[model samples]
Every structure is written in C-alpha cells, then in structure tokens.
Target: MTRIVNCVKLGVATEGLDEPPFPGDKGMEIFENVSKQAWKDWLGKQTMLINEYKLASFDPKARSFLADERRKFLFEGNNEMPEGYVPPKD
Candidate 1:
C-alpha cells in the first residue's frame, strides 16, 4: 500500500513519496510532509527556474537558490513565477 501524508504543499492528505527526494534533513522533511504530486510539480517549476535564470546546477549558488525556492514553494505557498515569463495558452 502507498503511504499517505498530510501534504504541506497541496494542503491535503495524499500519496507520499517512497523515499526522500534529496539528502539530509530537508529531504526527510519533504518525504514526511509533501505529496508525490507536489514534488512532481516542483520538478517542473525547478526546470523553468533553471531555464529562466540561466542557472547551472553545478554551481553552488544556483543550487542554493533552488533549495531556497523549493522550501518557499513547498512550505510557504509562494509560487511566484519568473519575471517576464508568459505561459503558453493551449
């Protein structure tokens, strides 16, 4: 049976990830409080953030920025889009 968590990001009880998404306390926190769907959504947003900001994943600063953004997006409900970003209408 899949694990269900009180997802902080989605504000609902939902299916949780099988394991922590990253290494360390933050990852464990996410594993405990965030849902699978919310993590997937963050992956997409992270990609957009990297592309929009021209961030290199190898750079420590970029990684730090993404980590901060991840926490804000997941725990704080701050989903601010990058400046000048226009969503494609389908």
Candidate 2:
C-alpha cells in the first residue's frame, strides 16, 4: 500500500486526483479513503529525521511523537553518534 503511494508520489503511476480536501487519482484511493482526522493524527505524530538529521536534532518530545524505527532512521546517519549524545546546539 505504501509502495503504491510512493509510486504515485514519485510518478511511477500515472493516476492523478481531481480535487483535494480529498486527494484524487488511480492509486491513491486508499489514502483518499482515510479519514481527515486520522490524517491529522498521523501528521501530529511525525518526526522528520531522515536525509537532514544532522542539520539539527529531534528533541525528546518530538522523538516521542514518532515510532521507534522512524526515530532511528531519522538520526542514524553514517558514523552514528554515541547512544545518549544529543545534537550540539548551533
């Protein structure tokens, strides 16, 4: 299911939506069917840790918002820091 969404997002699939507030397209039906409240709940739980994790660090409160693997994936870049080390203040 996620692969399908990723494909749609990456344009591997040609489907598209007509109106938003509800998303459109061929492969996005599942996402389109999800409740708006659920979408907000998911967003509230987000912690963006990938690709640019070292630009700063995620605070514990933000880390707490994400699932474990997502947390790891966000900060565990090449040559990982020691377990308890926080990103230094800029």
Task: Score every model by TM-score.
Answer: 0.95, 0.24
Q: For residue 52, what is the lDDT in candidate 1?
A: 91
TM-score (C-alpha, index-matched) for candidate 2: 0.24
In model 2, pairs of residues that clash are: 16-25, 17-24, 17-25, 49-74
Q: List, in order, the clash count of every candidate structure.
A: 0, 4
RMSD of 2: 12.9
lDDT of each: 0.96, 0.36
Candidate 2 lowest-lDDT run of ten:
1-10
lDDT of 2 by residue, 4-29 (tens): 22222232442333323334552144
- Tens digit of per-residue lDDT, candidate 1, span 1-90: 999999999999999999999899999999999999999999999999998999998999999999999999999999999989987689
